[model samples]
Target: MNVSNLCVLTVTVICMVLAWSEPSKACGSCTCSNGVVMSCPNIVQISLRSSGLTNLSGSAFQNNKIVTNIDLYGNQLVHLPAGLFKATTKLQTLNLRYNLLVDLPDGLFKATTELQTLDLDDNPLVHLPAELFNATTKLENLYLSRVQLDYLPAGLFDAITRIKVMYFWGNKFDHLHAGLFKATTELESLYFVRNQLVDLPDGLFKATTKLETLDLKENQLVHLPVGLFNATTKLRKL
Candidate 1:
């Protein structure tokens, strides 16, 4: 073969070998027989949402370490096994909406430091472990609507300084503790609608100076604290 032809042939062989060594991205890595996973692929995203799963096998994500997104919405899961996400540190988005979870184990999210968005809406969770979100410093959007939360532990949000949008609608909160959002200075939108709150502390929004939208509709407020919006000069909606 000529030198030019020999160079082309060598390049083709190298390309083929590299392609075969890379993990498949053609589809999700799961082998489901009658709606059950018999084998899982080690890929970047895994979606088994609405699969009627009441429980997950402990080995569901056994050897898959590079996952970035997981969708577990509309399942019947009452609990997640501890360390379920320990190996998936690169995970960025997790959807757990419409589940039956009442509580999460302490430090459940300690390893998902790269997480950005988390949806836990429409669950029966009445409370969260203190500092459960401390490790997710990069989180930006959080959805906790209709989760039956009545109160939050002090400093619960101190670690999530990058949070921008948060949902707290349809809960049973009658009061909000002071400085609940002191660390969310970059927050833009906040939803507290349909709760049982009767009063708001003065300057409750002093830290959220960049807030643009605040929803207090359907609450039980009789009067607002003096100068409640003094710090939120940019607010455009109520």
Candidate 2:
């Protein structure tokens, strides 16, 4: 083959290898007959979202204990097993959006200290345990939108430092604690739409100096907090 054709073939092989790099780690040992995984990949991420898998068993992740990102969005998982991710503690991003998870067990994310982005939106979680995000310091984006969270446990965002965006829309939050955003100095965008909050604390954006967007639409807020943008210099969206 000519040089150009040979080069094209090499690139095609690389692309094909990358497609199967991420193993199916979402619905392991499921009775839904999604087929056997056979082998767990040592790749960087695993995505089995919306795979029509009915039964979500813990053994599904036994083989792929080293993968970093695990996306199980839109699955049939009703309950998460405790220490289910203990072996995959090196994980960075975990997307559990649009699942059937009703309640999150304690220590669910404690082991995944390297975790950065955690998407728990569109679930049925009523309350979050304080220690749920225990030591995930590098965490950046957190999505808890469209859930049944009535109250946000205090100091829940303490360990999360690299946070840039946080989505907590469609919740039942009537009162937002003043210290909630104190630790998130690097935050940029915050979406709290369709909530039950009445008011926000004054100067809450002082600590969030990097904040640019704040979406609190369709909420029960009667008034915006005073000095809310007093410290926002680069405020773009509201």
Candidate 3:
């Protein structure tokens, strides 16, 4: 081939590669439909499950301010930037399950006040900040199963007064605080299966009057506390 022709072909190939590698101007690094990326608006859901993501930049979703649901399930994320979701104020459901998260920032969900369901299951989390859910006041369904938690800080769920379903299965908890569910008056289903709990505090479910299903199977409990279900009038399955 002539030198001029070879040079032109090389430049054309490079341009094509750059065009394909460049991220969408609107969605940043997040995947978006061709039409959506061109328009750069109306993005409501972000699903990046099983994408082998190890970490995310703080500005990953900065342009997706009105996004409502974000699914990052089955990834390798070890930590999340503190203000990762600062602009996602309208987010309702966040799925972080099946990741390698060891701990989360205290105000990770501060701006996600509209959040309702949060799934943190199947991670290796060791500790949780007491005020983690303080700003998620609208949270209802919480999934903490298999996170390797031994103890939960007091007042952890104080702001989630509207919580309904909670999953605590497959943990290392030996005992829980007496007032753990003090603010979960609207709780309906509570799962504590596959834990190391020896005995439960008598008033643990006192404030969970609306609780219906309590799963305590596969625990190390030797005896039940007297009047444990006294206030759980709506409880049907134990």
Candidate 4:
């Protein structure tokens, strides 16, 4: 071919390649459309709750992945990818309420260190990793309501002392590790409603001097432990 023709072809090829180099839409926040989900961009929050997405594996939510909140409510999904939110490190909140999550990977939320609020309500989790919230030291609110927990591991939340409000309602808990709340001396509100607990440990509230509210309604508890509220002398109304 002539030199001029070859140069023109090279330029055309370069332009074509550039035009076809759109970024891969690996994953992104999505919305449900007519009972089906559709991918959308620039979404900061995604509410896929109760949409019945049984298997959330073939997702490409890694593309424009600037999401901060993801809701998978009332689904049948039992597993989550370990690094699911590693690409969305800027995320601050996550709501996995009312699902079928049985367990989570140890470092599942390590990338979301900025996460301040987390909700795992109404799931079927029988056990949770003691270090589940170790990396989320900035967490202020945590919800584990309506799960099937029978006991909690000792010193589970030792690293997160900044929590203000926590909910442990509607579980099958019979006993709790007393040292679990050692780091929660700054706690203000706690809920143990509708549990099967028979008695609290001796020093249940020894370190919670700042506790203000305690809702133990509807539990199978027959009596509270000695000095359970001694440190919490600020208890105004129960």
Q: Superposing all C-alpha atoms, what RMSD in Å does each candidate have to the true structure? A: 10.8, 9.4, 9.0, 11.7
Error of 3 at 216 (Å): 0.4
Q: Residue 164 CA error for candidate 2 (Å)?
A: 0.4
* Clash-forming residue pairs, model 1: 29-41
Candidate 1 wrong stretches, greater than 4 Å: 1-42
Which one is best on lDDT?
3
Residues 43-106 of candidate 3: C-alpha lDDT, one tens digit per residue: 5666766766777767566666777888888988998999989988999999999999999998
- lDDT of each residue in 150-178, candidate 1, tens digit only: 98888888999999999998999999877
Runs in model 4 lying further than 4 Å from the true structure: 1-42, 58-60
lDDT tens digits, residues 175-238, model 4? 8777778898778899999998888888877777888888988877888776688799877657
Worst 10 contiguous positions by lDDT, candidate 1: 1-10
Per-candidate local distance difference test = 0.78, 0.73, 0.83, 0.70
Residue pairs with clashing backbones, model 4? 26-60, 27-60, 27-61, 27-62, 27-63, 28-61
Q: How do these models rank on lDDT, best leading?
A: 3, 1, 2, 4
C-alpha TM-score for every candidate: 0.83, 0.80, 0.84, 0.77
TM-score of 1: 0.83
Regions more than 4 Å wrong, model 3? 1-39
Candidate 3 TM-score to native: 0.84
| Total clashes in model 4, counting residue pairs 3 or more apart in sequence or in different chains | 6
Once superposed on the true structure, which residue ranges of model 2 sit more than 4 Å away at CA?
A: 1-41
Superposing every Cα of model 4 onto the true structure, what RMSD results?
11.7
The top-ranked prediction according to TM-score is 3
Best first by TM-score, ranked: 3, 1, 2, 4
